[model samples]
Target: MIVSLIVIVVIGIWLMSMYNGLITLRNNVANALRQIDVQLKRRHDLIPNLVSAVKGEMKFEQETLEKVVQARAAAMSVKPGNMKDLAAKEGELTAALGRLMMLKESYPSLKANEEVNKLMEELTHTENQIGFSRQFYNDICTKFNTKQQVFPTNIFASMLGFKPEELWELPADSPERENVKVDLSF
Candidate 1:
């Protein structure tokens, strides 16, 4: 009876440890996603100002400007937890912004304008933040998923109803995945 009591105590401690670790990992995954969301929000907010700064100089490229605007709207409308849809919308926005950025290379005045240059720099910085946040989010997701899939932990994880976190990824065919072609020739 004493040996059985010790076995029960040991199993209880192990179960508690697993539960706490899984909870911490799950929360980390969520926090990582929230960081990505914050970066995306910054990007969305910056788009209109950037577009306004360049609108006059790129008068002929209304379609490109409009595409950026529409993409931003679509990205903002998606539910925050829907990673796949949000990623696709953001990809469209990124591609549109990329085209807008390349146009600056063609227009000497836009490149020369201080306001446009500053806004462009801010947008570029925000893009870098977004990229970094996405990588962090994916890393957390890998940890959470691995925790729920490895060894004896897997057995208890499912029993506890902990589900795997999804990693954010752009589809292979996404235009954002394509290398940007910039022409420097006047």
Candidate 2:
């Protein structure tokens, strides 16, 4: 009887530890995702300034400017925790920004604008930060998902109502992954 009691106690402790570990992993994923949001917000805030700085100079490229503005608005509308929608919107925004950058080759005047240049540099840096944050979030999500799938932990995770998280991945056929084409001949 004493042996049985000791075994039960041990199992209870192990289950508690597993539950706590899963919670930590889940929180880590949330924190990492917040980091990505911060960078994205910074990038979004920079867009209007960038658009206005080049607006007068790139009259011929109005379509590209409009696309950027529309994408930014769509991206801003996405709520936090909607990873799938956020990824899709972000991909669209990135593609629009890429097209806007390509216009620099066609309009040297835009490239020379000091304010536009500064904003572009800040946006590029924010993009890099977002990329790094995404990688980190994915890593944490993978860890959390793995923990939730493994043998004994899986049983405990499910019982505790812990669900797997979606990773921030661009769709396979997203045009954002495509190279930006520049038409320099005027």
Candidate 3:
């Protein structure tokens, strides 16, 4: 009887450990998402200043600027949803920013302007930071998802409503347009 009781207690302790592990994984995923949010906000804060600085020099690219503005608004207004939808919206915003940067290349004056140049440099740095944050978030999601889909943890995860997260992937053509091929080979 004492042996049976001890075995039961051991099983109970194991289950609790599994449950706590799942909880920590979930929290890590949430924290990673929060990091992405902070990076995105930094990007958003830089946009208007960029747009205003380039507005005059990029007069001919008004449509591109408008698209960036609209896309930013759309991204900002995205409703709470599953990770898949959120990831898709993030891709859309990335595409919009890509277009804005492409448009920037057309204005020689804008490129040379000291203030605009500084803001552009900052924006570029912020974009890189956001990309890093996104990778970090995705890595956390992978960890959470792996545990949630595994054997004993899967059972606990299902019971606790833990679900897989979508990877933050770039939209098709996002990278293609963002980095234009400059044929430097002579």
lDDT of 3 by residue, 1-186 (tens): 999999999999988887888888888888888888888788788888888988887777888889888777867777765545556666667777777776677678877899988997898898898889888988888988898888867777777777787777765654323565565574
Model with the higher TM-score, candidate 1 or 3: 1
In model 1, the runs with Cα more than 4 Å from the true position are: 182-186
Model 2 CA deviation exceeding 4 Å by range: 179-186
Q: What is the lDDT of candidate 2?
A: 0.88
Q: If both were scored by TM-score, which would come out higher, candidate 1 or candidate 2?
A: 1
Overall local distance difference test of candidate 3 = 0.78
What lDDT does the true structure give each of the candidates? 0.90, 0.88, 0.78
Q: Which pairs clash inside model 3?
A: none
Clashing pairs in 2: none
For 1-186, candidate 2 gives per-residue lDDT tens digits of: 999999999999998889889889999998998999899999988998889988998888899999999999999999877888889899999998888876675677767878878888888898889889999999999999998999978777878999999988998777787776655686
* Candidate closer to the true structure by lDDT (higher is better), 2 or 3: 2
Clash pairs (backbone) in predicted model 1? none
In TM-score terms, which candidate is top? 1
lDDT of 1 by residue, 34-146 (tens): 99989999998999898888888789999999999999999999986788888989998989998888778889988888888899899999999999999999998998999
Relative to the unseen true structure, what is the C-alpha lDDT of residue 53 in candidate 1, on a scale of 0 to 100? 84
